[model samples]
Target: MGSVGVAELRRSLDGLLTYLEPHWDFVNCHMVNYLTDDHWQHFVPEPLRLELNTAKDLNQAIDTLFWRSNRQSQQFPAFASFLAAGDHLRLENYEKLLTTVEQLEQQLATSTHTQLSIKEFMSAKKCHEVELTAALIDKLVQSKSTPNSTSFIVDAGDGKGYLSSRLALQYGHRVLGIDANTTNTENALSRNRKLQRAWNGLTERAELQSQGIIPARRGKKSNQQDASIIPPSLENYKTTSRFITTELNLSDLLTEHFDQQSNNICLTGLHTCGNLASTCLQVFHAQDNCRILCNVGCCYHLLREHFSQQEFFGNKALMDQQVDCGFPLSCYLQERKVRLGRNARMLAAQSIERTLAAKELPNITLYYRALLELLVCRHAPHLKNELQVGKVKKFDSFPEYVKKCADKLNVPWLATVEEEELLLLLEKHEIDRQYLELFYLLRMSFAPVLESVILLDRLLYLKELGYEHSYLIDLFDAVISPRHYAIVAIKQ
Candidate 1:
């Protein structure tokens, strides 16, 4: 209800942990082998399942309880009450524990308005992120007691240099974009070259739009001519390929690239993946010169948990080289030995709002995959959940899906199974399709709550370090960019 302070964050963390303790299995269960794993019997209570099955429109019911209805206002069904009373899984209670995006935004007065145009180069979502982030960085730079014109921004995990280009070109700030991939660095430079050429036209279009005047569409020739009109040199925007870590010194890197020395620095990343976000925070704390941090992290599935026994998703050699884990950055979670398993972390990445808005459901391939698991048990027991049958081409029927999967998995025994048997298997489990869909929706509903825990942990980490100005700003529209909250801090 109030701005999420340390005390409030701690309380919310405790409440969320308590609420989620009982449902870890449901969160962690692999949907690929739902039936084979006996997930329904193990996790879902009979009464709730029965109620869901009996609903006239299960899709509508899922939408109502999961997305459309708020805990306090909505008239809940009998199943909802059953979940709350018997299982201690109350949507209303969970909602109360979460620090809402609105609450986070209210803590800082940010302008949603952007000076840049949504040109054909960037999506509306990306345009929004870059403009907003650049504005915040500008404000942060201005707020510094000893604001230096020589101050530069360090864009970590700066893929394709969207934010970096904007900061350098539009805001007149020196930006150094660092990414792990050399290809990305090259591509970012190429993209920036194009952006620099069309910068004037883009700004003019944005200005016209602000004044309620839509710019006229230009022909291919006109567009080419506009692109040929190169703006002044953007030597300020430099990029490099380096996998960033906490130990990586920003001051030294700045000197290496720009051939200039400046202690005043703002470290930023737009949707920095997994450990890179954590690295940005660590780098910020490690370097005295790094005064500001604005990071939006994504790919929670890739986060290396300190307490988790699960195998790290990325290069294990690289992970082992890391000094710290991605999760439990705060002393509170670390002391408690908190662990959100890889499966749960993957679930946390889901977007319930976007799913509901699109009226989307899990692909039929999900059901097919689950069914494939059944065949794997019968034919190749050793290969059950072991086969890495990734994405398959679209198929018209279950038998076709099986053949394609078998070929991909190199499971000759599975491929040999008769088509009639596959059809019969499909017919027998016809009702299970609905069950799995419902189960998927129910599991996805917990996404935001799980995400809140992760985000709060990062915020709490900053708080633990005695940074008074640290904030978790909900900077973008949830539907457009699910990983919207920016972990911002201005070191005093």
Candidate 2:
């Protein structure tokens, strides 16, 4: 389970695709289309549906199966045979196919790595991500066979410069933060300036806390002096607003910014969105100067798939303009024509652990939306699936939800419908609410399985490229940061 090699990764991908192929329709189906499409009847097996209906407490049973079973090895008495009944329902089989966080951490041996104190300026989650990712980048830098003392870091999609600022101000690495938006670049520079001013006091306070000592409050003048104590050499971080792509040359960009020729460049990103993550990998391989890569990607929903026929939620026109799609980075997937629809990729981003920890479920709006689809089909059959009834404000009842949605969609005829009719509609379909909730949970159980496919595809891409030093490190708490896995590689 430790750092999986090329052969093992290929086998895992093949097995995952095999298992997912039969259930693609389930994974790809939208919740909005649930009632109209007869999803419950089509997707849920009769035995499973009967078990759910006959359970003493369906909610408790679902909670036990989804959360307690995975966390504490506890299963609902009624649903004990759920997993054994079918391969699709078995969590153990999915677990067997995935490379776990523990295994990835063991492979990297990152638990013992010392981290810098920088919690004062970021959230607990961001603090965790930055500290771990920055530490890994430093380790990769030091591990280089031809380690250059002047090796610089290139932080792609560097929003507000959190990681780049830490790498420069604390770790003393020359860093260039690149982002797409101009406002982001300006804000990152401003944030870095403020961080520089506060670095000394922050570090001193962190050290005192570590040693179990509480320092007395200081005056404004004393704090100002502490802020001024930052060394001149530590101000090596720079940022630019430029859209990143595979064809972009890192070496040329470096020379343009720092006015120095550098061949040893470490390309890193913290939760780079959509195509940018794959773009970073492609840039790393395309540019000789990009000797190292450490990237943690998020927003799988925005990824453009070459083989997918469905339109994604993001800018489809812009996505079509791009040369390389985000998914299936490896030739193995490309050759097989692998495709993960937008809905399935979006599901991959969900965090089951966090949901379990909070004892959360899908909002009632999902049920309301599904119910509204029924009305849409009955009245406006042509607009079915075409209506963009986005998020409506909180409503106390089903009629209120319909009114709000109708107003938003500018369908006056829908709003003019009698309140009694809406109430009757709600009464008729009241039983479907619990069924929809069960469907939501059942689909969410596949989140990690889908995520594993995307991550393994990226890892296998590196393997296919003959990168012997590449590794996938699970670098953060999954509940705190769901997209916690980082793809790291070093050019030999």
Candidate 3:
């Protein structure tokens, strides 16, 4: 494996792939109740509870579980053995192997940090992604492939143009925001107008605030530009959702936009969902114009799995596509035909750091969902698999919930379920709910392991294609942005 660039991902890929295989079935399979499905028992260990006989006891134990969960990071006390001794320790316990962020940035070609002159008006997560992305864009624009002044930025799946607006307005790069929906494009354009209008005096506000002075008095009018004052970003940006109805050719789009030179465009996507993220990689390889790529993807369950064990829902063409559906894109997994099911992909999107930091536990809603599934099995056996009892908190009692569900599903039989039968079912599973809650937490431990495999595979693909400048940067604070890892690449 080449150690200097993209090949560095290989150092941890083998171990991660190994850990991802055995747990694939556990993570991907649909959650079946531990009471009903005996097979699931093996996956969930028996917990030593504080006697969940009463409502208070059950609630307390559940709270304790959350307390423990929120305190967890990629590693925990119970996982010490597995994390240290497991075959994939390099990735499963990434805190040890990935080294420091400073080291990683050196290899990724992160440019020197210059204090941003403009004010940042976004959520912490959005701000982190933008700052990190801007840093990478700096390196790419100054790359030897083309003149830095002529290079442009293309934001794929730009939702409300948070990153695009900042890149264009703050960074002064000509940016085009592309979305699959016209509504998003319109909303982004409108928001950009508002941001531009508010752009005046933002720097002064930052400077004054740093020195502990109030920037302005809220209700007092000051010398400011009109709301319609268009900024350089608004003038440079054009957004449309027409791509939803048409095939996208980045090379053609960039060529048309700039007559300066081909291969001088930087393609970026923030939280691009499903195949769109994978498609970003494909675009990098297919178009020479797309010389730099910074992609962070989410909603793994939405990706179509080309491998045999892949999920069978959403976008029929994705399943039928000639290329792989975002899973195991690297030759390593491709050769083994490693398949991660839909559930596993969903699990991969989870954040252990966030959960631990907030003392967050599995929601009571999930417990209700599973318990409702049991009620369906008993009261309405025929409609058990057919009915989905979603969000029943509005009802005060079990019978009211059942009746409400019956109305939604149009099943008269559910309405006929006796109050006594409902009470009996809830009472019986009372303690089991706590057990299930603990089980859910335990299963979540495998989250980072699975995510590492998917990410490393993407990196390996770029390396195999002979682009050595590729690197995976640990971009954001995990608690702020769960999907914080970004795949960055630049052509030689």
Runs with alpha carbons beyond 4 Å of true place in candidate 1: 1-4, 53-60, 66-78, 81-114, 145-149, 220-230, 312-323
lDDT of each: 0.78, 0.78, 0.67
Higher-lDDT candidate among 1 and 3? Answer: 1
Q: Write the per-residue lDDT of candidate 1 for residues 1-492, one digit (tens) a residue.
A: 434467867887887798788888888888987989878778876666655544355665666655554333234465465333422332224443333444534544454435666555788888878777787776666656354446889999889998998888877789899998899999999998988877777777788998899887754546345455668578999999988987788889999999999778999999988788888888888899999898999988878888888563646665666666899899899999999998899998898769978878899999999999998898878887787777998789888899898788787798799999899999988878877887887788678778888988888888788887787767777788888888888777
Q: Model 3 misses residue 144 by how many Å? A: 4.9
Model 3 lDDT per residue over 193-295, tens place:
8888666556457567767787665455465736564445367666767442124766566556554444477888999987778878987888767778888
- C-alpha lDDT of candidate 3 relative to the true structure: 0.67
Please, what are the lDDT tens digits per residue for candidate 2 over residues 1-492? 434577877888877777677789998899999888999899865766665544345676666676565333243433455343333423235453344445544555543444556587789999999888887787676655254445889999999999998888767788999998899999998887777767777777777877778865744656345443544454588888888887778778878888988878999999998878988899999888889999999988888887987574647655665677988899989999999999999998888768877777789999989888888888889988888777788799988998898888889878887889888988888777877877888777678778888988998898889887677766788889988888888787
lDDT of 1: 0.78
* Residue 237, model 2, lDDT: 88
Model 2, stretches more than 4 Å misplaced? 1-3, 54-57, 70-114, 145-149, 215-228, 231-234, 316-321
Sliding window of 10 residues with minimal summed lDDT for model 3: 69-78
Candidate 3 residue runs with Cα over 4 Å from true position = 1-11, 32-34, 45-121, 144-149, 210-212, 223-233, 242-247, 255-262, 309-324, 389-400
